[model samples]
Target: MENNRYNNFWRRLAPSVGLFFLAPLVGEYLLGNISIKDIWALPFLAPMYGGGALLIREVTRRAGRGWPTLILLGIAYGLLEAGLIDQSLFNPSFEDHVLQDVAYIPALGVSAYNALAFIVGHAVWSIGTPIAIIETLVPARRTTPWLGKVGLLVTAVMYIAGSVFVFRDLQREEQFLASTPQLIVVSTMAVALIGISFAVGRKPQPKIDRQTPNPWIVGTLSFVISSLFFGATENWVGVAFKLLLLALMTAVIIRWSRCQGWGIPHRLALAGGALMTYAWGGFVLTILLGRSETIHLVGNAIFAFGAIVLLIIAARKTHDM
Candidate 1:
């Protein structure tokens, strides 16, 4: 009985912990920042990124929403982090970033290009990708809520506390952008986006007679589209083009999903495409890290290969289902 109880405790805790690692591990460490190597940072980061991911996932799932609604919420999360917490979008010299002026708007006091890329990064890679990968790993719990009411309250508190902590840290590193008016505007917009997601939650998918495409095709398209999204944010014009591309791709996916035979395979493919970006980007970004050059690059390459294999296996399993 003790053993069974122990196992149940672990079962209940696993999702939150798994999600916690996903944010720092994949989003920060694997992506290039090596600070996550410090054990002390885990306490702080786990609540920030991990807590945010859990909050987004739980809120959407508990509300009975599907992937689309979850993605929208994830977008809101991204905006909140970039716009409010870090203010990277509005900071002209954020961390002395390379493209600080890429799409600088003097009047609005924001980088249009960076704003779009960062928000999309958090939405798809940081939040959505981890949720998909973790759910794939635990297929039995894929559609189910991972926490009860008490657990949710705890997670929310952690998230809010982490957000305040990050805001203070970022405040010291750089002077904040445009302050009150911008804060109010972005906050309002983020809330509105979240409201929209809830409003459209879990509606029944439309039906059609068209056959679903091959999983490989879906994955490849996802990879290509996502790559475009990642690379196309150097300037205002590119930002505009990328937005149009995103809208078109979204429309295509919605239309295709409504057709006959769409299922887990297609869904996994779309997710795999986005996941692949991180895999390869991990390898490329290793060069920019500026230390242990060959070794870091090789490690990133290995991680990328392993991720591809895992994704392939997941695709196969989805196909069987």
Candidate 2:
């Protein structure tokens, strides 16, 4: 009985553990925002990125919600990270990057291009994509809650503590804080998005008579579109184009997902495609940032290879399912 109980506990904990590590790995490391040299900081990053992902997943699943709800919450998490925790949304010089120089919005005190990139990037890559991949790996528990009440509470506390730690550390280093009006606006927008998520999730998906596309096609399109999204220049034209692309992509996905043929393989393919974009995009970013150090290049290659291996595993698991 004790052995059975132990096995069950580990089984239940496995998905959460997968997500806890995968979130930061995909979000930070694979994206080349932090290279091998900075790997030491992962322990610090895991709580905020991984813990937040776990909490968001648990809450959505517990509420009998789905991807729509989780994606919105991911955006909310992005807002809190940029606008509140790191204040990167308002910081003109964050990490020596002139974030506000391009497409600056004076009224909002943020770069329009960056605002879209950071928020949407966090939503899709940092949160939604990792959850999708992990759930695909554990198809049996894809829609089920993985955590008990105590686990949920612990995740929440860890996320909060991580956020506080980042916030204070950045505050001291940057010595910058967003204005009251900016803070209020960001807070309100985040809350509104969260509320809208539940409302939108409650609405049933529209039935589609059309057949879903082949998984390969779906994956290719996802890869191309996501690459375009990240590869766009930091200008008003790029921003406008990305917004249009975002709307179209959202509409198309919503329609495709409603088809009866849409299943685990298709979902996994979509995620895998996006994941690959970051895998390669990391190299481009490194070159652009002029960090052409051999170590950084090698690190990007290693991370990209790891992403490929993970996708292969996910594909095999999906096939078995």
Candidate 3:
């Protein structure tokens, strides 16, 4: 029985696992190894790739028994590539190539290895955590989180060991790191928010009753908090929004963490909260959290697209669920 169930598990896993790594793999196959131009493909596809599954779920819900919407999602996947890509860095000159070859990669001197490590690590955690939660929450074929936990824990342990290498290179990376105060503030806040997310991962939360949203105070606060993000735009508001979003996420996280108890589908909301938190973290970190003027240049492309995609999915799901 166990062996048969394990076979069924692999059946479900195969497609998603393919979809997950397949995005990057296909990009490389067509283009060649990751390059500055090709890798810019990272930010755009990263969100959609994972969100694609949810996107499929949403479209199917709306279409009501049809593969047509699923086909549409495939086309939209191209829009993700069409959206924006900065290929300026492909300078693969002697110096750039040398730097990469010498056990290094960097986003402004912080270490390329470190950034890649984080991306790969997050890719693993964010992708699996949601599916595991869904497995447990879905009305049928639910799997225990302990099964998920054991896998996640083993992978996390390996990632951490590699992170030790990053810590050692932190100082070496400092030379390429931003010297500006704003960038420092933003990156610091980003690290903190990610840390909180690490703690919140995949733990089932108590559902916030959708019908009785206690929106009285919390909803108002959510709106206010969201507006703070908007206002920060006009006035160099990186740090403020970063902190506010974190606080907001933290609050909702506590409420939703009891989803198993509340009988509400908090994943939609928690996904919203997670998206909000990580989206802001990515924004803040873009130019060292809030320092570099270059942020505006790349900002709208990555964050805006991800937000629009997320908000659309969230609104539709909330209405349906």
Candidate 4:
């Protein structure tokens, strides 16, 4: 009985563990923001990215919520990371990026373009994509809560600790803190989003009679759309275009998801497409950052290859389901 119980515990915790590491791997390293030489930072990043992802997933699943709720929570996570932890959204000179130079909104003390990019990037890629991929890999436990009460407490504590560590480190290094009003606005927005997620989740999903598109087509479209979304220039026109694309993608996905034909394959394809985008896009980003070193390129190749393999395995698993 003791052995059996131990096995069950690990079985239940496996997905959580996957998300714990996969979140940071996809969010930072796979995106080429952190080079291979800095792989040591993964442990530091895992607490915030992985812990947040686990917390978001556990809360959404335990509440019997779905993707909409998860995505909303992801946006809230993005807001917290940008506005509070790292203050990148408000820090004009963050890592010498000079983010606020373009599409700067004086009243808000933020760059409108960067705000959209960071928030949406985190929502869709950092949190949402990793959750989708892991859940796809373990379909049996997809909607079930993976962590127990103790686990939840630990995750929360880790997230808080990680966030505070990053916040303090960045504050000391940059000597920057967002204004009180800016902090207040960000906090308010995050709270509102969290509230809205639960409210939206409570509503019954509407069924549509229309036939869903083929999974291959869906995957292709997702790849193209996500590619375009991330490739947008850092300007007002790019911001407007991204917003339009987001609205259209949201509408289409919602409509198709409501249809009876939508299933695990479609979901997997959507995630796979987006995953592929980052796989190749990482190379481009490395080049753009003028870090086209052999090590960086080699790292990008390894990560991109791993992504493709993972997607293939996921596709096969999804088909078996």
Candidate 5:
């Protein structure tokens, strides 16, 4: 009985924990900011990031879908974060991000580059990475809902409350976009994205001739490509070029996966590859950017290394499975 209770406790808590850390790990720490130094931030961050991931993962899995659906939900989460909650998508100047005129749509007040990068960043790193790692860690539970209806309701409330807090804070910084029409359009699009995800996720994926690649190769390519992509964000030209490369690689992967050789290992490898980019790059950029103190930088580096090791282990386990 005690064992069952302990198991239930961990089961109840692990998903939240995984999601809480993952948001900062991938979104803040790995991407650039070492918000780990700010203990005061976790309360708000936890609800916003953790709740978003948990809700999406549970909803998609409960719907009997897989990564593709999760990816769609991820895109929705991205839109929510960048568009509604933080309004970074519409912010003319966010964090020294000079995206106002980079393919800016005057009517929409949206920058094509910023929208794409932010959305993809949240989709791939913030949402996708954690889900892949957690699912890989416990493959048996991959398809199950981690939260019940009550739990989900609580999570949704927490997420909304967190968003309100963030939106208020952003407004204080004068970074808030107050366009109601834009808000309506983006919110409608977010809803549409979620609907599309559920609709597509309900369909069965077609069987194909799987051509699985070496997990290491997949990880390496993902690392190199994703690293280049992240690095290119420094300039508009690089961003455009890398976006093209990203599209090309994605197309190739999808086509290749249609073959029978594609399996669990390949999927994990692809995830690991994307994650490895941030793992190593996080350390180097943290130092170069001087975003944190020496101690914080060193601590973040250690964590990054640990993450890479764990991801590698997970990749191996996924391959073996």
Candidate 6:
């Protein structure tokens, strides 16, 4: 009984784990050097902290339909950073486009990057969240469903579209002046479409047990401690942040899996965590490699291959269950 309670405690603590850890990490990364909008983005991804929590909370309950919010947050951030803000910060240019004149009121001083951030965020979101919602709507049964696959495809398309916009806009500022609306309009349309669906078929929200110890309590404390370790000033001192994050994430994944005992969703989370770790680790390795001239392609291949093999094994087990 004690073990069950201990297990339940861990189960409850899962969602807030990322938020609590990610905020200070962002602050340390920024060191208070950037604009308020940039600084705002430093923690909890600015304008989207609530959205991030909503995603995490939803995922932990009701088979995780809340992933869409995460995507939306990502899209919102991207639109702000890449589309709107970068107009000046990364690639400065003045466009006399009529729409932008309206977009940037003389008083607001809002950059093109700010206006376009939602596009990137919306695209990233469509990939992860929409599929999650549909799956929650009708989980995988015998029949292969179209909605899940379509959502995933849309994610890829949005990412590509965002990338194209970035590259083209960076090359010619006027192209961006004309293209900005295309990005915002599409993103707004998608949100409006999804909002209608979300409004009606309510996603289930698990109640917090009154007797249960709050998961956020311990999770938040651990996250603060983790951030301090990773948020060190010296680059060398913080080389281990990804490693630490992965270790904690792995522990969380393992505990959640064991607590739930190898069901479909638990196994899926394990796979997702492993993928997250592998992706982060791969990023670290690439940074260490340091240049395209002397890129460590062979080492990357080995890591990728090994991760894929592990993923396949775990997936097989998941299927068997």
Which 10 consecutive residues of model 5 have the lowest summed lDDT? Answer: 31-40
lDDT of every model, 2 decimals: 0.78, 0.91, 0.37, 0.91, 0.76, 0.37
Candidate RMSDs in order: 2.4, 1.2, 14.2, 1.2, 2.5, 18.1
lDDT of 2 by residue, 1-321 (tens): 999999998988989998998999999899998897888998898899999999999989988888889989999999988899888999999988889988998889999999999888888999988998999889999999888899999999999999999999998899999999999999999999989888876867776788899999999989999999998888999999889878988888898999978988988888888999999999988887889789999999999999999899889997797
lDDT of 2 at 119: 89
User: What would the per-residue lDDT of candidate 3 be over residues 77-167, giving only the tens digit for each residue?
Assistant: 3222111111111122212332233223344432333222233223322432233234323333232122243544443443344334333
Candidate 3, superposed: residue stretches over 4 Å from native: 1-143, 146-153, 175-211, 214-223, 226-267, 273-303, 310-321
Model 5 C-alpha lDDT versus the unseen true structure: 0.76
Instruction: State the lDDT at 239 in candidate 1.
Output: 86
* Tens digits of per-residue lDDT for model 5, 1-321: 999999999877786677766765676666555545664576667788777888888888787787778888899889988988888888887755555777777888988777877898888888888777777877777778887789889989988888788888878886557499988988898999988887774655576755666767877787788877777754467658778877887786766566676766766777788877877766776767666577667657666776778777786677566
What's model 4's TM-score? 0.97
The TM-score between candidate 2 and the true structure equals 0.97
- Give the C-alpha miss distance for residue 177 in model 4, angstroms: 0.9
Candidate 4's displacement at residue 34, Å, is 0.6
Please, what are the lDDT tens digits per residue for candidate 6 over residues 73-186?
Answer: 444444444444334322224433222332343333443332332243233222232222223222332113222334334434543454455456455654434245545754
Q: What C-alpha lDDT, on a 0 to 100 scale, does residue 293 get in candidate 3?
A: 53
Model 3: how far residue 84 lies from native, Å: 34
lDDT of 4 by residue, 125-240 (tens): 88999999999999998899999899999999999999998898888899999999999999999999999999895876888888899999989989999999989988999989
TM-score per candidate: 0.90, 0.97, 0.36, 0.97, 0.88, 0.30
RMSD of 1: 2.4
- Single out the weakest 10-residue window by summed lDDT for candidate 2: 199-208
In candidate 6, stretches whose alpha carbon ends up further than 4 angstroms from where it belongs are: 1-74, 81-290, 293-295, 306-310
